[model samples]
Target chain A: MNRKLRDLGERRLVEWIVRRLEECEGASLPPGDDAADMLFRGRLLVSCDMLAASTDIPPGMDLRDAGFKAITSATSDIAAKGGKPIAYLVSLMLPPELGLESFEDLWEGFEEAAKLYGGRIVGGDLNSGREIVVDVICIGEAGRTASRLGARPGDILAVTGEFGSQAAGLHALLAGRLEDPEARRVVERFSRPMARVREALELAKTSAVTASIDSSDGLAESLYQLSELNDVGFLIDDPPISAEAERYAEKFGVSLFDLVFYGGEEYELVLTLRSKLVEKAVKAVEGVGGRLIPIGRVIEEKLIKVRWADGWRMLERRGYQHF
Target chain B: MNRKLRDLGERRLVEWIVRRLEECEGASLPPGDDAADMLFRGRLLVSCDMLAASTDIPPGMDLRDAGFKAITSATSDIAAKGGKPIAYLVSLMLPPELGLESFEDLWEGFEEAAKLYGGRIVGGDLNSGREIVVDVICIGEAGRTASRLGARPGDILAVTGEFGSQAAGLHALLAGRLEDPEARRVVERFSRPMARVREALELAKTSAVTASIDSSDGLAESLYQLSELNDVGFLIDDPPISAEAERYAEKFGVSLFDLVFYGGEEYELVLTLRSKLVEKAVKAVEGVGGRLIPIGRVIEEKLIKVRWADGWRMLERRGYQHF
Candidate 1:
């Protein structure tokens, strides 16, 4: 633990990671091979996600959470495509001064997330940089996928899970308020987000979802993206706001609407399905130990509107921007 | 061109990149989709390679060269595995102060490398970081590969191309002696290295090669690795030293042996084949417009030796260490 990465060197660091990798099923090449080999006979889904310490890791978050979040974010893309993740390639850019313990924590987080998502951490690249950067490439497979351009007017708009918790959690962490249970829950949501891979995979089996998008960007921004791509609008009567987030917002006088709509990193799926097949979709999610929360309905008006206490309010087209 | 990434924002930057992507073959989903989709029916090879600005891009090299090298390095892994690359997913961590023109150059280099390697740049992720970092994930297909652990005694050791040019080139570039033609040639080798993908692919078809490894980590180091893995030794009677490198070494009073064995980033392939099947392997490589240079033979004893001018000399197991 006292040794830094510079002392361990890149080759030994790779050896350490190889020692921790669980035997990857169906992997023809061993863990330390130059490349990971997997035989498949279907559609292949590929996505890459990057997270850096400067912008991604908040003050309260650690390297382990950063690594987990990086994998989760990449898996969320696969889930949104209705694909099951099979393997991952992680490329890390680490500062020379990073300690071996921190590096181990990061790898542990990667292992934990891969176990949770049923994928193998097959192979990756490592280099030296000014700060820690984790880039995860997810390889998945699926028979069919729900695309953002497939939405139709009169479809039910739903989410895989509640929102606003991540936003509220970020706020609570920033304010250093973890004494309250609700605040702690929200903070945990913000720190260690989970991908909706199981729910999306099960829902896809029903073939009821017309369109899908990952809500890593704010929920409102995801709605706007789907609207633009499908040339449709949404009328959201019930936003899937979290109960813990609600209590925290009420106690802190925070805007619940903003928290639910504008907060990002939710890792949920904002999707649409035929209103008639709602029962089937709900049953599929429930079968997988998940729940589908209906938030609104797709419309042809080309505008997003939310039913608030006073009247319908227009949702802006904005989300988290990297730069 | 004058605008910085911070001013352009992440959304517009992504849009610009999407606009620049070529028409990807067999891509079920469009360019801007969250994940790239492809259909295949064989063994899949996955590898990732990362290059950072501080570590990878030398003083004279630009972002475009860095991007190209990043892709080339990753493709080399696939080549060593005897795989044909199908698609690439690039993830970039850029500094906010980077210029738009530089970013364009980087993308252009990626496009150029993809074209040269006969693959599509399907999808990628972008994020802000402390410096420029390009992590490319190569998804490829292969029928079979030559493993490093397959070498046997009396196997003829060979290389796909000459060496020492890259090391000499780097020295020339660092010494600011590009005015000389030989120096410039060596420098070009250092700056723009090509992967032995075609040669390795063709050689893999012969079914005569026993072991293979990409020699990017220097020729001597590659031999040492193959030796250790196969529990064998090599008697290197001949070193494939480039003429230009030899000239540069003489002119600069540098050791030719060191230049040939210790200089890294050659991007060549070191392999071992049965002496009787050498003709078949040579024919296959030549058919693909590449040459196979015979170096020596694998020995039963587990030691690496080079036939130096004075006598046989033991080669150290050392190469580039990132830290």
Candidate 2:
């Protein structure tokens, strides 16, 4: 018999959840306590992200991908600070009619993401609501952390990985182009954007890198955030638009500039580094099987300027805004 | 000029939030990093709670109370473990049409609650959604913590404060009896329930206490939780119903038993302690301007039995279940 969630009651549901969780590395207490206990070294880094079904989850995404994306989005913030994730506390609000099998799938996705990021789910809260809402609170540790305010005017602006792929993937998914191989690849990128944890940690160990942010809110928005925090401007010589994004833009008759500059959910780390240590930063990222693409320089002027085929144009501070 | 949330955008909203938060103690890094950093001593205790508009909030409760209640609910878990709250991360999912003043009111409530609990809002995420949802992730510290699985057969079961006050208040609110002073008092109790942090901390310092849990899911439900975790049962000699609740039950022609045993959101810490040190536990609670009411005892038998005016009755394990 397929048992309904209401038949299991809250305690039985908790037991099911507890049984599924593997023993976390640094957890001192088990999952049944009022709170889970963990021992950590160095400075503690904490960030939270909430993914709502109506707002965060797009078309063609399953519950598993939603769960994975929720955790990845929060961990991406930790990566921006050059911190290694230690643990996660998830708070899930589910609809009353949600089935047990779907709940299990969501947890499986959460565990898969934790395994990929080298963190564990130590504790969480489960409640009932109108729509599915997953709030992930990630705890990380760092010896020395990067901040957006530390960039200087003469620093070189660089980013990890290509941009606009997730945006293009989202477009393709919305347009019912899921069967195409290229479209599938980009959509996969949207579903599971890799957090730059290894690359950011490597850069944090060096004195070269200064300011940093996760490019989840589009490359232009990330640049604007850094500029606002450091009171400086960015002059981009090369906008790193991925080939797939370019193709999607051409085929769909959409603005390539919009795809590259304003699209969100990239999960790439955008950083400002010392001009002389650009090669060192590049080598460190490459050592981790990642590429550091330097595209611009920070300027004293407090405006963002991008170079196109025509000439330099001032870009508006636009990206994904929840409200 | 009344500004809507969508008009202000996410960046401006964040700036508004940042300006409102005072510098929290023990936070090494500021709020803008991927995560806030905190220095701590002893074992780190972490818990999270999410409150959604459709389910959690009752009629007549404003946005400020919603925010305060959200943080308090999470901190109540920390209190159950005898931990002192250090910081909180708030993630808000707001509808776009929400006014700026209402947003400010929500933050004010969060700040007020943190100040009351001796913690601070360190960091958070703000997103758009159909309804308002607040998720609070609390981090606390403890030297020696209490757990549900530690109760012995001979342990004296005790609870902090009176039961059924919050339940009575909820009844009054739902019944549209807001004008009566007694009803108003009960409603206030439901609106602003106190977490027994100081009392729990004091109890943790002594060797008398063995097992503990917060009675957020009603008194019977809490006893069941302890019973299940410790592989034991409870013999209740006294049901800790408040005088106000009894009066309310009589006036409303409702069952007093249901009001006291199955009502939720009390935020009282239920504990099992050594019978010999019952006086010590009472005195410790009194030292913190609280009362410890001994209601039961733990037994080896795996069933919960209650002593009523009629006779001993086997209590049904029923309480509020989210699913």
Candidate 3:
């Protein structure tokens, strides 16, 4: 029996969602309280992001994936600031005709994110709208956060992992190549993208990282943002492109440069560290079972250039635009 | 000249909104940063509420009122828990056809709320959706929160202010009676509702408040919620109905009982106070330039009743259902 949301009503739906959430430890006030209570020691990191069905969810994505992306993408901002997420407050606006089983799947995706990030889904609200829109608010704590404005000349530029997999994954999914074994890796990367929370937490504790940002807005755009904010430039001798993306680019006759520089939703950490302590930072990330791939170095000139076919070429300052 | 959002692009529009925000003192990271930073001493109260143009916006309300109410209604949840709002993070999902001037008016409304609530609009995101949707997350600090589970038998039930004005105002606006002199008062209440932040804070500090809730979902529903949570009943002998609402009821031949019991969006605080310290609680609320009107008392039976012409009649457990 498929029960629709209108049959459950708003109050019962809220109660159902609340009951599904795991009990948060040390919570003075639980989900039933008027507001969730969080205890933090130092500076609090807060980030809010909205994921709408019209723009955010691509074709071949499920409601559960949307829910996971809603929380994961917002937590990416906290990961960029080098913080550990403590709690999440979600607000969902859904169409009335949605089925109850669909909502359960959507909330199951949120539960998956909570398990991965170690943050509790403390409380939230459910409202009726024209489409499925999930707005997530993540609260975390930070010590010596790495803002986008701290990179200086000669700082070593690095990333948590290889890029371009997400872009390739989307292409594979859209081309109806999901059954291909070669496409499975890239497809999983797009559907179940992981934020570099563990790497960021470990890197921030090393006292060597200067600036950081999540590469959710593509590599070229993130570099441009850092350049504009810090009044510096970047020289990338090596681009960290995933092997799966290379195979996809070769098969589909797509430019690897565009895939690596212009494609977004990678959720990799683009960061700068002290030149002298690069080895220590790499060791710290490795200690947490993560890879730190050094891409380039910060320069004095206010132009981002990458090593192309013959010589250095300027990278365009454009990325995925939401509006 | 009118400029649409598609002309400005997402990055430039974000820059425009960030520039309009007032500088927050002691904020380590501002709007452009990866995440906002807030420093608080005690338990933090976090509440998130979403407002969509289709369901939340009434017929006569402007975009400015929508913006103001979006923040005010969310802040009301924090106020109900006896928390002082410290920071707000807003996430907007807008359509591409929206004009820049209209967006400016919406931001102006948000600025107005910031000024009134003393909470800085620290950081947010802008996304493209099918319609205008605003989701607000309020972070606050509370010394002692008045949860709905704290109400006990023999407690004196009280309210921060009278109700039904908002209901009357909605009626007046829908029926095209805005030009009437008496209608202006109710219309203003409906359009520009105020949250009882000051009174809640003062009452919480007095150590006399028991359980509290915001009357946003109508007086009867709030009473039913309190009853279900605390396993106690309410006996409202003197229903605190506003004079404007009574006038509207008499003029239009509407039921005064329905207006006082079932009308919503009042933003008043329905609370229970210690029987012996009622005087102290009243004084504390008055000290903050607000009123504390005693309505009735909490009873042992788990059923809400109101005094009518002959005797007390059972008040229905119903209110505004969003779905």
* Each candidate: chain B TM-score: 0.96, 0.96, 0.96
What local distance difference test score does each model get? 0.86, 0.85, 0.86
Q: Candidate 2: which stretches are off by over 4 Å?
A: A1-9, B1-3, B26-28
Interface RMSD of 3: 1.3
C-alpha TM-scores of all predictions: 0.97, 0.97, 0.97
Tens-digit lDDT track of model 2 for B43-148? 8888998898888888877778777888889999999988889889888889999898888878888888898998888888888888888999988988777777
The docking quality of candidate 2, as DockQ, is 0.70
lDDT of 1 by residue, B1-323 (tens): 49999999988898888887654555566777889888877888988998888877877776677778888989998898888788888899899999988998898888888889998888898988888889998888888855676899999999999988999987887788868988888877787788888998888788878888888889988998888788999999987888888898998899999999998888898899999999999989999899999999999999998987888999987788877
Per-residue CA lDDT of candidate 3, range B1-323, in tens? 89999998998998898886554555677567878886656778888889888888877877887788888888999999998888888899999999999998888888798679878888888889998999988888888777777899999999989988988888888888878888888988888888889998899888888888898889998999999889999898988989999998898888888888898888899999999999999999999899999999999999988997688889997787766
Output the lDDT of residue A246, model 1: 90
In model 2, the Cα lDDT at residue B289 comes to 88
Q: Give the Cα-based TM-score of candidate 2 against the true structure.
A: 0.97
Task: After the best TM-score superposition of candidate 2, give how far the Cα of residue A205 lies from its true spot, in angstroms.
Answer: 0.9
Cα lDDT tens digits, model 3, A96-211, are 88999998989989989977998988887778899999999988888767788789999999999998888888888778787887787788888888888999989888887888
Q: What DockQ does each listed candidate score?
A: 0.78, 0.70, 0.76
lDDT of 1 by residue, A179-287 (tens): 9888888888887899999998888888889899999888998998899889999999987888888999999999999999999988999889989999899989999
Which lDDT tens digits does candidate 2 get at residues A1-323? 55567777777888888776654556656675668887654588889999888988887787788788888999999998888888888888888777887787788889899889998888888888888889999988877878777899899999998887889888888888888887887888888888889998889877788888898889888898888888999999897889988877787788888888998988999999999999998998899888899999999999998997789989898788787
- Candidate 3 steric clashes: 0
Best-to-worst order by DockQ is 1, 3, 2
Docking class of 2: medium
- Alpha-carbon shift of residue B23 in model 1 (angstroms): 5.5
Task: Give DockQ: model 3.
Answer: 0.76
